[model samples]
Target chain A: MTYCVGLKLDRGLVFASDTRTNAGLDNISTFKKLQVWEAPGDRVITLLSSGNLAITQAVISLLNEQIRSSADTSRTLMTVETMFQAARLIGSAVREVRKIDGEALEANADNFSVTFILGGQIKGEEPRLFQVYSAGNFIEVGEDTPYLQIGEHKYGKPILDRVTRTDMRLGEAAKLVLLSFDSTLRSNLSVGMPMDLLLYNADSFTADRQLRIEKDDPYFQKLSQDWSDALRDSFASMDELEV
Target chain B: MTYCVGLKLDRGLVFASDTRTNAGLDNISTFKKLQVWEAPGDRVITLLSSGNLAITQAVISLLNEQIRSSADTSRTLMTVETMFQAARLIGSAVREVRKIDGEALEANADNFSVTFILGGQIKGEEPRLFQVYSAGNFIEVGEDTPYLQIGEHKYGKPILDRVTRTDMRLGEAAKLVLLSFDSTLRSNLSVGMPMDLLLYNADSFTADRQLRIEKDDPYFQKLSQDWSDALRDSFASMDELEV
Candidate 1:
């Protein structure tokens, strides 16, 4: 299991994904799940993946392979004209991996489930966030629901449901995303960190505000501690149940 | 789908269960998942069920049928010697339902998955809490982890993890449990109101302190609104992310 969240605020798109991957309890290891493709001022795309590591890595490799060949610019992540087209390219990449490996995985009772969060900007269109399903179908975040999360999502969702808005500033959205991670990390063991954080300012068309927060990052530690204390206080302030 | 929680606090046990039952997104209705059996001053036992409504209702009916027979008091919930024995009785009831319906459900490609949280006090012993599984096995909660939840649990779990304590007063625990429900009802469609809440003080040996909170219950409406506001404020109080 893993946890990754992408927020499409008016100011920008903010994304975060944990680095932990495990087959069993004892076989845990750190692996980066966030990938970025940049054509400098032309386009910037951020992708975060969760589910079967082999499948996600294969999809990423196929994507990178397409980028390197450059023979079909329309199909490459770096050259896709719109975020919608880029999403379709990813969907095709997933189906390509499925056509290769889905059956054997099914026979072995190994799941081929993989999901991706793709969010970023092209020159003309605004920043957009999408949640791509294992079936390769996808849905975009909109004003009403400006955030999307994949993998181990329920534990951290309440805070996002309450605090997130499309007009939120990029920094404030980043804080909300980290707070979301804080709740997830405390309750679930499958999603561990040092986390990969990416902040793309809307219309900037560049991936400049990115940070890799180590497990012991002081700011995260302080934020987590403060959030916990504040949450408890808020809980305590509620009226006592008369019944 | 349903959401039921049982907390074993030093003061006693608190149980809450939503009344929603659904076959799918469109076929949803109300059904109580909380059951109680009491022998006045002798013992008080509360049961919360989650999973297939058919299996749970059958299990409850089986338990009630046994209670009605009364020829063998030792095998009945009212005559159970200890809380552990009471848990065993419920587990056996689950198995009885499985024996009757498991194969038929399997043939239809339907699942027989069901779970239960049992908590309360019997005479001559301290309060005890056990989570009974479909396979007639159960595990008790201890001091370290003082609460058990089943069915659609994760969305509301973080708050329970952060604030629940064995020494919490019954009223305080009830408040926390409601806050947990507030989170669940907001995020999940399968779990809804009206909710059945049961609070049992330690060694009370009677089934009392029960409340059925209707969908339009004023207190619950106020609590939910207050919690939403307090939570947002708590989140806002956190520092802006440096990144």
Candidate 2:
């Protein structure tokens, strides 16, 4: 039970992920689901993961190991030549974790599940966002639908379907994204706060505009309260079915 | 593969069910998911069902047979003194269907699944609402929630969560209910149009106010279009997150 959404706007990419993970209702804890790899002026790759925490953390650790290893400077995410290559590298990392743990998890009737949102830029290419699956396959955001979401997605989806466009301003899109989170958080208990939010400006090649939203974050509180009031007002304004 | 919602409001109850049912992507068909049994001035009961069409149809057929026979003079829905008894009758009908088909379905690796929302009243009781599960257990709507939904419910739930209360006007609540369906219809392929919608008034004990919304229904079209515009306008009014 997690919710992470990434929007590929005309400006850049906006990524947000909740911090709650639970093995069951009673065993809940906070964990970072957003992983960032930035090599200033060269590449900026961001990932938001969901599903079995152990698998996601393992996949992230494995990717970090490759970056730390002196043996493979040619092909870590930081060295990937393009955003497409970075997505492929993430796919391989997931498959690597699956190879090691999928069988044991299956025997226990626990799914060997994990999914990721991979977004950012590598020099010479435009900013791109992709959703990578548990099977190590992926789909990229297209202009017609310039956003992707994973985990507890349905409650937040209708708003995105209605409003998301490729040309939205980064701040405007961030506002919509948080409203989406507001819908999800209100409906689902498993997806809780403080969320990690990052707004990437295309071609910046740096991940500096990131914020962590706590439960009491004043701006989010105001936005959430305002959206609720607006929805009620809007609902009241609609003509009731008269037939 | 279906969406049905039943809301218990101050006035009475509201029920809406999509007509689409599918066995697979290639084998989809339109079927009536809302069943109404009314003996004008005696009782008015509406049942909205979801899950294996076979099971639900079988359950309804069994209940109809009992009413048609001269044998069950005391306990048919028309004769039941309270809405609670009517709910129990529906649950027993479900269990009878399972007794006959459960093992066969399980042998074929199919689930013996069906759920229903039963809402209405008999002569002696106030309007009531209940959700009957596959195992013949049921839950009555309390004042705290006052509504129940089954099948592809998440996309439609947030709006209900935000706006539903025990004291809403029947027409206002009906507007909210149809808007909930609009959200589901936009996101899910298996829930489609020509929906059966019924609104009951307390103490009337007659089923009237029922309307079938065809795909080309002008009022529905206007409502759907208006909702989208209203949402976009509402989004515009909300302040953007500045952090």
Candidate 2, pairs of clashing residues: none
Best-performing candidate as measured by DockQ: 1
Worst 10-residue lDDT window, candidate 1 chain A = A70-79
Each predicted complex: what DockQ? 0.84, 0.80
Off by over 4 Å in 2: none
Q: Candidate 2 has what TM-score?
A: 0.98
Q: Which lDDT tens digits does candidate 1 get at residues B1-243?
A: 789999988888999999999988999999989998888888889999998889999999988899888575557887778989988888888988889999999999998999999988888999899999989899999778989999999989989988887888888998889889989999999999999999998878877899999989888889888888887888777788876
**Per-residue CA lDDT of candidate 2, range B1-243, in tens?**
999999998888899999999988899899999999998988899999999999999999988888888965658877778888888999999999999999999999999889999999888788899999999899999888888999999999989998887888888888898889999999999999989999898988888898999999887888888888988998888777675
Writing each residue's lDDT as its tens digit, candidate 2 over A49-103 gives 9999999999999999999998775698878898899999999999999999999
With candidate 2 superimposed using the best TM-score fit, by how many Å does residue A182's alpha carbon deviate from the native? Answer: 0.7
TM-score of each model, paired residue for residue: 0.97, 0.98
Top candidate by lDDT: 2
Instruction: Give the clashing pairs for model 1.
Output: none
